[model samples]
Target: MTIRDTVIRTLAHTNWRLALPALVLTCGSLIVQAASEDPEVVVPTASPTTAAINPAGVVTPAPGTAADAASGVVKAPIAAVAPPTAPQAPAPVDEPLMKLPVNARHMLVIDDTGRVLMAKDADTVVPIASLTKLMTAMVVLDAGQDMNEEIRIEDADVDRLKHSRSRVRVGATMTREAALELALISSENRAASALARHFPGGLAAYEAAVAAKIRALGLTHTSLADPTGLSPANTSTAAEVARIAAAAARYPAIARISSDKSSAVEINGRPRELRNTNHLVGAKGWDIRLSKTGYTEEAGRCLAMRMKSGGQTITVILLDADGSAQRLRDAAAIRKSLAKIAAA
Candidate 1:
C-alpha cells in the first residue's frame, strides 16, 4: 500500500489529538538535545571591557569597544590593553634636584634672581665671623674715602676681645686700599679694624653706616658688633648673609678686592704677600665671581660665594661647618649638583 494510506490506517486505530500533543513534546526535546551536542554552535559572552557604573554616579567607559568609540568616548585599541608593568622605584632621599649631602649647619643657595635653589636652617641666626668684612667693605666704599690714604694699624686695632693674632702688626701702616685687600683677601682683623677706625667719623660712624646699609638691604636678621667680626656678637642668618654678599658684589672695589687670590702690600715698610682665605678663589674649574671665608670658635668655618656655571649665576652660603675641609667638600658637592641640574 501507499505510505499515506498506511499512516491513515494506523491513526484510525488510535486517538490522533493526544498522539499529536505527544509528538510535539518529543520533537521539542530532540531539538534542544541536538543543539547542546552541536560542535559549531557558539554562545555570546560578556565583553572584557564592559561599562561599569558606581553608586556615586560615575560611569567608567568601556575601553577597546566600538560602542564606546561611537559615543565619543576615548577607546583604547586592542593592542593597547597590555599587561601591567612593574612599578618604578622612588628617587633617593638625597636627590640632587631637591637635596644633596651638606655638612654645614646652615646653608642657602640662590640664583641671580634671588630664587632659592636649596636651603637648610638658613633662617637661624648665628655668628658670621669674618663674613662681616663684606659689610665693612661696603660701608667703607659707600663713604667714597680715599682708598689710597695710608691708615696706621694702632693698638686699638688689636683684637682685645678675641686676642686673635694678626700679620698686620700694631705699628704697621698700609694704604686703605691695601688694608681692605688684606681684610677681605686674608681676613685680616687688624686691617678691618683700621678701616673702621679710619672712617670719616671713626668706628662709631662706621657702625652707623652698617646699620643704614642693613636697613637699606632689608636685612632684618643681621647685626654687626664690630667691623672685624672678631666679636662673637657679629651675627647673621645665612639668608641675610646672602643678601650681604649680593650687595657686596655690586660694589666694584669690594668685588675686585675680595676676589683677588693674593695681594702684595708693604707692612711695617716691608713688602709682604697676603693670600686669599678662600682657596677656591684661584682653584681650577671654579668660576668664582665673589668669594669669602670666615672662621671662629663660635662661627666655625663659613664660606660665601657667587659662582657662574652653565651660564647661570649661583650664590652659595655655608655656615658653622666642623672644619674648612668639610666646608669645601660641601661647596664642591653643591657645585656638582648644579652641573647635573644644568645638564638635565
Candidate 2:
C-alpha cells in the first residue's frame, strides 16, 4: 500500500481520542515527506526547427522530416529523464553526542610547550570558582609584598562569607606568607581577601592589577571579577588557565604550598591542620608541581595543574567535571592519548 494509505489505516486503528489528532498531523507530515522525495521534473527541450506554413495554410515539412527528403516526420523532443538518481547513502544515524556530568563543563590537558593534548569545550568561558586563588597568589607574589610581615584578619575580612570554605578565623593573626599558603592549600577565601586588601593601593588597585596581570600573561579569555574564585563572574578558558598554572608553578613558594598535602596553621589561636584539596598531589604516578581544586554551584568541581607525565612536563585544567573521579579519568584519558601519539 502507498505510505499515505498506510498512515491513514494506522491512525484509524487508534482510539478516537488519539486517532483524530494523529491522523491530521500524520497527513501533513506525510505530505511534506513525499514532497521532499519527489524527483525533479525536467521540461522538454525545443526542436531545432519547426515546419513552415505557407500563405495558403499548407504545412511545409521541416528539414529533418521525410517530406523534406532527410528522415521520417520530425520526432518530438523527448524530456530527458534523469537516470534514476542513485539512492542516497542513508543519512548517517547522527549517533548521540556524548554528554558530560553536571559538574564538569570544560577540561584540557596540555604539554609543557603549550600543546593541547585533549580538550572538551575548553574555550567556553565558565566560572573558575575558587581556582581564582591562583591568580590572587600570582598577583600577591608579583607585588613583592613582604611575605614575612604579619597581617591581622579584621572583622571586615570575615564579614563577607559568600558561603565559601575557609581556614582563616575572624580574630586570627598570621604572617603574610602563612596566609598565602593557607589560601592556596586550603582554598581559604578570607586569606585571599586579606591579601587583596593589603595590596599596594588596597583592594581597588589589586583588582585592577589582576586584570593587568591577565593581559600581561596574554590571557585574553580570562578575567578576574573578584580576588577569590567565589564569584561566578570570575571566568576563564581551560587553555588560559593552563598557562596561568604554568606561570604559577615557577614560584618556589607556590610550588611549596601547592604540593604540600597537609600543613598546620594557627586558626583562632589554635593549630588546625589544613590539607590540600587536590588529591593528586601525593597520588601514585603523579608528579604534581602545583595544583588547586575548586567547586561552586555555578562552577563544577574544577581543577588546574602542572605535572610530569611519561617524562614530559604537562599542564591540565578540568572545569565543571562530573565528579572528582571523572576528573581523574579525564586526565588518564589524556595521558593515554599522549602515550599513543608518542609511541607512533
lDDT agreement with native, every candidate? 0.78, 0.70
Q: How far out, in Å, is residue 161 in model 1?
A: 1.9
Residue pairs whose backbone atoms clash in candidate 2: 103-320, 103-321, 104-320, 104-321, 105-320, 129-229
lDDT tens digits by residue: candidate 2, 10-77? 76788767677777777788777777777863323222232222332122222333231122112345
* Candidate 1 residue pairs in clash (backbone atoms < 3 Å): none
Model 1 lDDT vs. the true structure? 0.78
Q: Which residues of candidate 2, in runs, are more than 4 Å off? A: 1-103, 159-161, 267-270, 336-344
Tens-digit lDDT track of model 1 for 171-290: 888888889889889899999999999999987888899899888777777889999888889999877788788778888888887788888888767888988889888798888889
Question: What's each prediction's TM-score?
Answer: 0.72, 0.67
Error of 1 at 242 (Å): 0.5
